[model samples]
Target: MQGIATQLKETPEGQISLTDPDARSMATYGKGTGLVGYNVQTAVDTVTHLIVAHDVTNIVHDRAQLAPMAKMAKAALQAESLNAIAD
Candidate 1:
């Protein structure tokens, strides 16, 4: 937990405050301080409503997560390549 707190504190952009380390804003609901615990990503099939991929990260910024998460998701789904998206 302390390591995560340190990471959040040192992150340069969209640094999530650690005052309350277990809270976060919904993607389309409520107001958030751009602070909180984890960054989670999920990729679901529109047709089947099944989660094809997902990841939970301690880093705050979304910018750096794209490539890593995409790679992880591809590996998890056993896909050669993927068209990844995030918000």
Candidate 2:
């Protein structure tokens, strides 16, 4: 798997998932812990608690996801504007 290793080394994150290329390593809340999986983002209705929108991404952090997830939720709801909160 030298080719795979080479490719992974070339990536900015220096990570590779053989089973699923879309999956990536994610840091955990605990120190020095991590997991390899897809980062799933979901938007739920405040009242109904039903999932309104969802997205699967390889991004390791949530900082950049707020706007995109909010936009997806807004589009799914067919709204002109949306008020969203992310934790």
TM-score of each: 0.50, 0.84
In order, candidate lDDTs are 0.66, 0.88
lDDT of 2 by residue, 1-87 (tens): 899889988988888888877789899899988999988999987877889999888999888998988988888888898789988
Cα RMSD to the true fold for all candidates: 6.3, 1.7
> Can you list the residue pairs that collide in candidate 1?
none
Q: For model 2, give the 10-residue run with minimal summed lDDT.
A: 13-22
Model 1 has an lDDT value of 0.66
Number of the top lDDT candidate? 2
Please state the error at residue 83 of candidate 1 in Å. Answer: 1.2
TM-score of 1: 0.50
* lDDT score, candidate 2: 0.88
